[model samples]
Target: MIDLKSAPELKALEPKLNQFFDLAKTKITAIDAEYDNSKGSPVFTVEGKYTTRGWTEWTEGFRYGISVLHFDATGDESSLKSGRDQTVSKMATHVSHIGVHDHGFNNLSTYGNLRRLMLEGRIPDNEWEKNFYELAIKVSGAVQAARWTERQGGGFIHSFNGPHSLFVDTIRSCRILMVAHRLGHVLMGEGDKPINLLERALQHIESTAKYSVFYGEGRDSYDERGRTTHEAIFNTKDGAYRCPNSQQGYTGFSTWTRGQAWAIVGFAEELELLKEFSDEELAPFGGRSEIEAMMLKAATATADHCIENTPVCGIPYWDTGAPKLHLLGDYMDRPADPYNAYEPVDSSAAAISAQGMLRLGHYLMAKGDSAVAEKYIDAGLKMSDSLFAEPYLSTDPKHHGLILHSIYHEPNGWDHKPESGKAAYGESSMWGDYHAMELAVYLQRLIKKAPYYTFFA
Candidate 1:
């Protein structure tokens, strides 16, 4: 429930967007040396210094993805060259990676974004260049689909945690499937059987809706509509569903904020993609209308939750029920104070979630649901308005992160906590940096009335 009147138009935010992208260039340049390919992708900043993180190795594409996005937004040739060169040099391995479940994140942001630009004619119309990006994306999607854990219903893209685990995060990664499907590619599975990328993507979306999102109808004791679990486990042998679990949250029962945000963006994005197809094109996978309806349900529920849970400034804590929030009595009515040492706020979550909110808002508006769409759209704008201001935007040249107050893994003692009082306010993350820029680009395109920003198109 943000005040729509309070949010500025995209045209008015151009200066801020330009400034942020300029600063983004500086910070990325600062971290170029610390990016170590062997140590997995750079996860998040720790104490204002860039360092390698060993998580899923899924964030490397974002490292280059953000640069490409910056180029698209600012027309900076340096950023464009940087993004293209890195994708060619550092991102090829990710497209063929079979051992991990991050093909969507690694490939989509790098190869997918590159291909999208070329399709839009933002890049030079070179057949060889376009084919190179297309091949990478096609391979990446197939590889992602290859790492599947089949179940009784539609299966899911397995997590990095082996065949038994399906992560809510992978929902966002499913865009790789959408891209490959558009390019007329299929995943080759057992006995060289061809698997439909669209079918797999749709199935994964439905599976995520089932296990990741709660319906408030007592599916379980902890079930509440819009609530999400970070991960869900299943039997690898028979694909029998096991139980709800979390690898990064405080507990299995608590909603990890980022995981919640993933559902918001993933479903909204799919809804947009599905809208492009006619009834016949989508009939093979349950008709475009039904699938779009299901996706809208998932996206709207999560967007509602984010709106309710987020503070007035439209940001959330690392966890919805972070134990320490009781200390700051009546905290939700105002902005999330990331400086609170008792419990750190996750700006990264807000950054990612805001974009999803905007996408859902736009989709809803397109479908003639303006009032509801306005709520989510204003909520998204409130976040963008706040994020561009002091203590959120990283204006410093020496700083390594673009958007500040992103906690990578707080439970494992993974984030940097400046000893007592040393001046640690603005921090950034690779995912946050990438998504925020993507979000900015989305808004910017709308203001210019250009081709709407969509992952599938």
Candidate 2:
């Protein structure tokens, strides 16, 4: 379990957060200066240099979003200019993109962060600029919602794998839909039917909560509470539920730690987003109590599982059931070994999940659940301390990555393996770098008592 006994308070981590932003400013600027955008979106690091991965163009937003977030943290007008200009120049396709389940990841990071900064008065409020960002968000949410698959219970936004596949990662991405709903937008379907974005988002959330997350209720022999299957398969012909599957993990039965992180953060963020909706607005989906219960169940379960399965430092290997994990006997009893010849640790997961844990903790505290909330809050802080320090934080001036040891696709052997080692390590990804910066800014906000950070805000 995560040892919360000595987790550093938010104030204590300010200097380290400051140090991270310093390193980040250098790395972000270098990537912007030297990275060849014509090649494609910079996905991950190869030998400490940024490289492109030819998946979807899912990471382009993070590229610009990092700068927007840096500006939020340090008032770097240059960074803000980069973020704003690139987002305007490069992100229009993403708003209307109908090919992938990453609208939230792509649009929310760039457009959403820019919008949030304007609302917070971190940026000068210009009505035209603000409208541009909000319209992008609204359209992005609707576009994301259009990729839906109906089932007996409800429906979910399908993954790029097609209408039959639902990915757990989309749970976090579902926020675009929620944000659009808040912006009074809807998906206009066939015959000009107005599809409710909030309803679609809620259905997607419920579908994910049901199939993607396991609750230790004997759903299968491998069923364990908080265990997340990366993908959930369905029979599209009749919309019948099929089985669990994985694109990035060891297997459907084993938890991929990053997918688990997505669940933890996705559900926690959704829980907080619910507070923005009035009871009347939420009544059609489910009452606030019911919605909170479902989200809380998933969030806390995954958070608990993370604490139980992760190393003392709170970082986890790429997957819980990576075949070679057994070679390192009782690995969870010690700090994670990114240098281990057997497996690679994913600092990106820790960075993403740390924010989830923190958000969940704060949400619970708002509900007067202090004792239980501290566990998650401290666990998040523990992850922050580990992620902000050596072996994880990249200090090398030549490296374009902000955080080290992020795995993109271990199953496909897509990560950069060291010449001396059998496993891939010492890499950073666009999502990983973006989230690390986001997490750092999140902590800094808490320290300064700034307006609470949220995508909707």
Candidate 3:
């Protein structure tokens, strides 16, 4: 479907991706700085140096995931060993963490990548090691899925905020359940409910589709076809939907670019898993076709917005409706300027969303929409190529982050607003750096003619 034959882009990218891994190993990973693991993978950088900022260890997985990707992309065995060793030494507690709603971000990147590597024959064929990885994934997925809130039709994995909150951010975490379901695992809920994880996955996807994603379908007064809210609040008593809310964005009504990226990545990635499900496996959720249609709709809408909202370089301001962005007239027509003193460009949004666009483009091409698919594919590749170069990439050894200008929480004033005071430039986020590696690895694999990165795989 991707039509990789004679891909000029792939041929051009293969060497650059490998070179990035080489530079990252020395500059980013080799740094002696270590933040409190409790802060979740060092939320952001100050003076281009990382420090702890998050409340939970939500991003530890990304740190570990980048290692796996480094090895996968560059065939650097030390990177692989770094990934395996870190998971063994530090990831056990994350697998069983109960309070936070980030098992997918914590355990999945570590355990999930380990299993995926072995399954791909990149790691040695050791059954004990494989089973260890699998068991960890099974429990991690079940534990994450067990954080449930039931509604009239079904339930969703609740956020750390408890039963009343559903975040677009958690959609990517639902992959923990998707992978667990593929392994034939299920979560045990109260009343001894044998909660089917696949069902819960679909339920959450469907819930996010209805509440978080805007389709200009008049679900609410603010609804626009491609607009998405960061958080969706509901009344716990009856699961009746409440007003839109946001923890990271400027306001409940504004679209957080990272949240939009999550919707794009979550739906696009899950759509691939949806195809792997058997008819019987999806019967509880209106069959595979119905589920596919649901996910496809969500992915499509998000990708459309991603293309429309981003600058020509495929980077976006942290929030589309960020109040001060009016200063940067025609930002969408040209590459975003990080020094505008109006708003910072989120390379993290570009890193995360580019892959989502690529996946969606591939899916559409597979589904007979090549004309539209090419646009998405080109957009994704354009973003990916930009991220691999200067200003975005950390070619400077002084910079501890791979991608720059990533904000952790703009509204909270937690991000380091550089000396300019105009925008939070000269920074990095754990998610941003991790997703940049992920974007590079996604393209790297395609160029190398290797197994595609898939949650189901």
Candidate 4:
């Protein structure tokens, strides 16, 4: 389990956070310089260099969004220009992308970050530029919302797999719908019926909470609280949930750590988004108290599971129940060994989950729960400390990836394994790199006493 008792505070981690930003400037610039956009979005590192994979075209935003986030942290105009130019020149398809459940991951990271900067007055408030971004986000959110698969009482934004699949990753993508609703946008359905974006988002959120997350109440033999399935299959005809499944983890019964990380950050961000709405706005769904309680229950359960399951340093293996994990006997008693011959650690999951812990911690504090809040915040800081240093953070200028030891599609044999190691290691993914930057920027803002960072902000 993650050793939260000795975890450092946010103030203590300031120097490392600053160091990470400094290193990020070079890493972001290097990727921008070397990556050939024509090949496709750089998916993950192969032997320390970035490469592409033809998987749903979901990562281009993270590639460009890294630059935008770099500019946000260090005020680098060059990075800003690269991000803005790419968003204009390259991201239109993602805005109208009707095939995938990643609009928030693609659009929010780029256009959303840019719009947040404009709202903060960090950039010149050009009215047209702001509208351009707003329009893009509005379209992106509606397009994402339009990919709905109706269930009994609600529905989900189905994965590219088809109408019957509900991916846990889309929980975070639901942010696009929330943002579009905030901007006074809605999806126009058949016969010019205006569909409420917020309702769609809420339904998707509740569906994920109900179907994707296991609460350990014996839904299945393998069910465990806070254990998240990568995918939930449903019968489209009657909208009946079929079974828990996995695309990247070892099996349907196992918890893919990255999917678990998605749930962590996804629900935490939803809680933060909820703060912006009035009780009246939330009444139609379940009212603010009920909604908050449901989200809080899911958030805390997953976080507690993470703390209990991860190694001492707060990093986890790609999947908790990876078959070979038993080979690394007593693994949880020590720090995660990324170089272990048995199973590789996934720093990318750590990067994403750390932010979730931090945000959930802050949310709890605001609600007058200081003791439990500190545990999550400290666990987040502890994970950040592990990720910003050697073996995880790539210091080699020749390596295009910013963070190392990220795994993608382990079940498909898609990740590159080192020539010498039996397991996959020394790789970084686009989502992994982007979330690490997001985590750094979050802490950087806190350290500098800057405006509190949120996607909506």
Candidate 5:
């Protein structure tokens, strides 16, 4: 479907790929420039804009993922050095505030940093670096186990706030916990405990699959009593436990593009872990067979939903059930006032989803589902290409983000209103740029690997 054999076609697109890479390099440099070591922690903001503003602890993880991709693509010592240096600098502040719940995001990415460093033999012998590394591992392991212990019902409660709140986005967030388990086992030399944690995470994932699947009768779509419809919004308030309601009372609701994307990627990663662990190692935590089956189901359901709902260009509106509306009121509404009522297509979410689907294709191929796997891979590649063609991704100082016209949530009234009074374009955001960079690196790898792996086998 994607024509991986089309070397001529791919070669024809070389210039665009080169341009995308150059743009990515520029963005990485810009992010590095925004780093302030004197602040003691990496600020989420870049050039006066909030990059990691909402959940500040996750910046280290984001940086780690980004840096790893950068190093893999370009042998630039500076990029690698910045990644390690930033980790050290950020950990200084993060370790002091190591709370109970957010550690998954903070530490998961840190583990990525550690894994990369260890593989490259870059672990420093310095007292601070050595101490922090061990401390990070221990703290991360403790937090992960504690979080798992607090699960309620089928899915995990979003955070420590309590049982009734479960955000689908946590699917991606939970990977940090799995990473901790894997890394802990490796670091400690031997033990089945890490395997146990991995199994627990899989259980939580299975529970999520049970409750959050988008199709089939009796599937929990919306809390009819809550007066909201949709899968996008999980809780009524920021930290509350109230269930979300549906829009029309019958169209099982609440499906956010990012949340769906998170589950798609999360399930795929779980499948990878399940395959890597031995059958003997998986017995204590509820056997690898069950986990594999659950992951396959989730991967299929989530990938299907993504393919059906997402635009051909690979961008998705905030929520699948968002009401189609247009701007009609005056432009001078208050910052907090609700105005627009449509789901703004989020390029970042689509990009991440495409990467997840690509990974899923590889996973499927590994299991011998060649034809179906190729379809997934082809769709993902085409989606990536379509997203790349969008002009909003141009890197200009006046542009706030890589892609323009992203909708945060129509119900929330957070559309990207252009600041420059440009009716044709919307506001730029950091999330879009980050995902675009991620997509570039992922596609580069996928393209390189396609020649050797036949999807039609």
Candidate 6:
């Protein structure tokens, strides 16, 4: 069993963290050579096997941001320049487009990185930086407002249009929105817009809470009102809408481990954002105490579930309730091609959740709830330590991906499969790695800040 109560010493992790960052930088540099900017977006893969080659909208920006964060942590000037240039190039092309639904994902990393650049004094007062920052904030606000759904208690929906489309992934997307709001406040000397955005965000969170509760109950995929109709669908393609002609529900009701991790991290992030608001401002939505309590509940519940279900290595299966491994062949719509059907633990999800738990623990500690906080942080630290020890992380030269054994499809009987040989990594997703890097950076920051805050108080 993964020990939640015991934490590996952080000092031991320094070398591993450095190695991971270096590996990430090397991989990112190699990948950049394949980017075809003339084609308008980054290509999906470098191996040239898959014909679908346009830049995937979100991942490109995410990669740039991750690169920036890695450089910031390591002070690698060349890596920093590469990340900055990539972000600047992408922001120039994509930031103004209103049609894209993933502005939060696309812009947050791009502009958020730029904001960090400005804060770090790496970039001078330049017009390009200024323009990108403004554009990011504007586009993010638009997307958040556009995706707002009344049925889900007022939270942002997953994408622009489509039935059966409420997703837990919005947790990450919403964090971008929060980041935009915070940036606007800090950079533009603005407050009202941030306040309004926070209110909208809180409403959305309440809606998510309500819909998520229903989803937990396992009703129909969506109600007539268009909220999540079921309670048991942990990971869904959409929030509450069901695919029209299929009883199987294209909603993707399987409990995606990363999506769950996103929720745990996202909720903790939202609580932090909300705390920035004054007590009076937060009063109407729910008092600060209530918000804190709700966050604590979510943190504890998800952390417990993650610990209980995570594998011995601290990685989690793609779906918590996935059917037995042997029975996978029986349910395959396609032949059990070893190419597609291999079960693997999602290392990225484990990393992200571990980081989220660490943050949640810090939040709890601030609220004078150290026991639960310690539990959460220790769990995260243990998971990170296990990930550090895995030989598979460095052994497979072809496996450019960070974590192994992630399941892209469990119902189709593809779990714990090697993503190395696959054409596109079988959705051995980019966002997972993005979150993993983010978790590492955040954990490092928290470790530094926590002692000072606790000591001074």
Q: For model 3, how does the per-residue alpha-carbon lDDT over 1-457 read when each residue is reduced to its tens digit?
A: 1112222364676666766787778654554344445444556788877777547768777777888877877677877777788789888888888777788777777888778878888878899998998899899888888788876676677888878888898998899888888888888867887988887888998999888888988887777787888888888899788889899988777889999999998898887776676788688779888888888888889888877777777778899889998888777777788777888888899899889988888888988999988777887887777777777877777777888878778888887876755888878887888888888877877776778888666
TM-score of 3: 0.95
Tens digit of lDDT per residue, candidate 2, span 381-457? 99999999989989898889999999999999999998665678888999999999999999998999988999889
User: Candidate 1, residues 152-184: lDDT per residue as tens digits?
Assistant: 777999887888888899998799888888899
Q: Local error of candidate 3 at 411, Å?
A: 0.1
Per-residue lDDT of 49 in model 4: 79
Candidate 4 weakest ten by summed lDDT = 415-424
Q: 1 or 4, which is superior by lDDT?
A: 4
At residue 271, what lDDT does model 4 achieve?
97
TM-score of each: 0.95, 0.99, 0.95, 0.99, 0.74, 0.76
Question: Model 3, which residues run further than 4 Å from truth?
Answer: 1-8, 32-40
lDDT score for candidate 2 against the true structure:
0.92
Badly placed stretches (over 4 Å) of model 6 are 35-56, 92-101, 120-131, 152-155, 160-164, 183-195, 213-254, 326-342, 391-399, 407-428, 446-457
- What's the true lDDT of residue 407 in model 3? 76
Model 6 lDDT on a 0 to 1 scale? 0.55
> What lDDT, from 0 to 1, does candidate 4 have?
0.91
Q: What is the C-alpha RMSD of each candidate to the true structure, in Å?
A: 2.0, 0.8, 3.0, 0.9, 7.6, 7.0
Model 6 clash number: 33
Whole-model lDDT per candidate: 0.82, 0.92, 0.80, 0.91, 0.53, 0.55
Which candidate has the top score in lDDT?
A: 2
